[model samples]
Target: MTDRIATFPDWQTKPTVSPVQGDLVYPGWLAGSWSMSSTLVEMVAPLAPEVTTPGFEGNRQFLNQPVVCQVRFLPANVVERNKAILPLLSLPTQSLVNAQIVSDRAFNGLNLAKAYLGDRVFRVWIDPRDSNRLITKFRDNRKLFSTATGRTVEQPDVDHFITTELFQQFFQSPEKPYKNQVETTTAYTHQPDNTVTADQFTAVYLQPPHPKAFLAGDRPVALYHYQLKFVQQGVR
Candidate 1:
């Protein structure tokens, strides 16, 4: 009989840290209302060359026109936990939460919609240990399960940041417009003139056999590039 041996993975020996203990800070410059415009610059369908993927038609429609949006950030109570205080440890220890609201445009810019595609409120948490790093949590009504991580760079005349997010859609059936994963990278610069500009790139990967000859892992399905401009209106 052959001798059998068992081996454990290296990750099993590493320690895990809790996410709740991390501190979150809000940037003062981003706390205000603004008018934002997003334009689709380029798009490519790598996997679905024969058929049109979902959302491609809409992107083409907005390729020549810009989509307008109203964005606002409101102050909210931030709470931190104190382990020293046993009975009231869960009480308010910090106040750094902000409520973000984004309104969508409709009717060919003739009218604004009462409802928004991003109607749900979003929250951003800055890392206490590192001011440049932050995390964003999406609302309940959002279409995908997403985790966003960002880093900021401070300059003399401009503050620049890059955010990368991983998204997984909530589709019931596997055949329902199969999308395995989507990654979005956005680079924003806060200019000296109090305006912000962003260049965004989004890539969608799909399960294989949609393009059978591709590699074993997920294949690239679509690529989208967008340009965004935000003009400060006033404080909310």
Candidate 2:
């Protein structure tokens, strides 16, 4: 029975895993705040303009103005989305930290002085190699299914000259849990003319169950690419 007792003790004394920590600092190019505006120019032929959908007008023009952008360091306790590191964090037993939110118009530059952009906040993290290659993450909790789920944010590489972004638009729907899911990535480069040029993704809309969802679709959606400019009004 002594051997059995010894085995029990070893099982009880197993070591617990700890969370991974990081102290990624924000870069200088992102030190100041930024304002973002986008115009959605959809496809003409494949979009089925005659579908009679208000939001799905073929070659439709949609505008989003003055979206705020910021760059900053993430807290040490926050874990990078490393699958290998997750098990080490003891996440199954402990709850993850809540994502921070920033909604002030001054911070977001949102004209929400009149209204607001749901819940506006973003957190940034640094890749261990070079701090210059920083990740910009965005989140809006109001888009979550419930307060429990919180908002989903993604990390994308961004630098002073160019950046890559990947994200989805979230919404609550009656037929399904979420609606109008979009996954997109655009390449942005700073121009010599003091404006930024977006090599926006040419493939826009993909059919349901998305790539992240691990489901297949009828065909890969195509994007209509364009060169939109970003100009800082007050910069001297």
Candidate 3:
């Protein structure tokens, strides 16, 4: 994981992985509500004119653009659950100390999707019992189902963390179901000033349903790198 961060966008292959079964734990420092911003710093089309993935061209407009949202990391003991699936779980300040931290995926996912996709996103729900599966509903009658198939995590020190997750996206619509693979690797650091920053790299791959899947093999057709900043906002 350390080597992957040092290499950055030159990543030649996918990161190592293991089956994703439960919630991904984080370092103690990350347990709090945060106001975050993600800016696209760079992008690359590895396969280029030969094999371009969907959205590769459309994403160019996002270069240097930042998406702002509210996100949180919480301890397992305080996360809220209900039949409503609202995901607006409350975070008690007193309970966040020295606890096992985990990402609030459903809440974070919905905020993130809307930040980028705008008002087109209707809602996002993650299976309450399983963090790996999530369904997204869009206002245009489009739906997206995603499953985290594999992941890898490393904490080399008390303040730094590195992780990679591999997932498959199944887009459902009247025309057909579009399938693809996505890999995201991120390195996060807790700064002395009580803020957090991360370097994130994302790659999009073509699946068998796509005509160039065989030719591309494991190479990513589209690659994107982002810079993220998080400041504690004391619960949204």
Task: Output the number of the TM-score-best candidate.
Answer: 3
Quantify all predictions' global Cα lDDT against the true fold: 0.44, 0.31, 0.83
Instruction: Put down candidate 2 lDDT per residue, 1-236, tens digits, no spaces.
Output: 22322232122111121221222233223221234444443343242332221243434433232333331112223334431222222332122223321222122222321122344534333335632233333363222211111122222434333222222334433445442223223445555664554544333233344432222132223334334445543221
Worst 10 residues of 2 by lDDT: 145-154
Q: Please give the TM-score that candidate 3 achieves against the real structure.
A: 0.91
TM-score, cand. 2 vs. native:
0.37
Clashing pairs in 1: 78-94
Clashing pairs for predicted structure model 3, backbone only: none
lDDT digits (tens) for residues 94-154 of candidate 1? 3212342111111112121211234343543434554323333346522332322222222
* Tens-digit per-residue lDDT, 1-236, candidate 3: 77876776676677789989676888878877789999999999977898897778888898999889988887765554432332333545566675678887777889999999899999898866666888899998899988899999998888889999999998998887799989999999999988999999998888896889989888888889999999987552
Sort by lDDT, top down from the best: 3, 1, 2
Residue 148 miss distance in model 3 (angstroms): 0.9
The candidate maximizing lDDT is: 3
Question: Higher lDDT: candidate 1 or 3?
Answer: 3
Candidate 2 lDDT at 122 equals 47
Model 2 misplaced regions, further than 4 Å: 1-31, 35-37, 41-54, 63-170, 174-176, 202-218, 222-226, 233-236
Which scores better on lDDT, 1 or 2? Answer: 1
Better candidate number, 2 or 3, judged by TM-score = 3
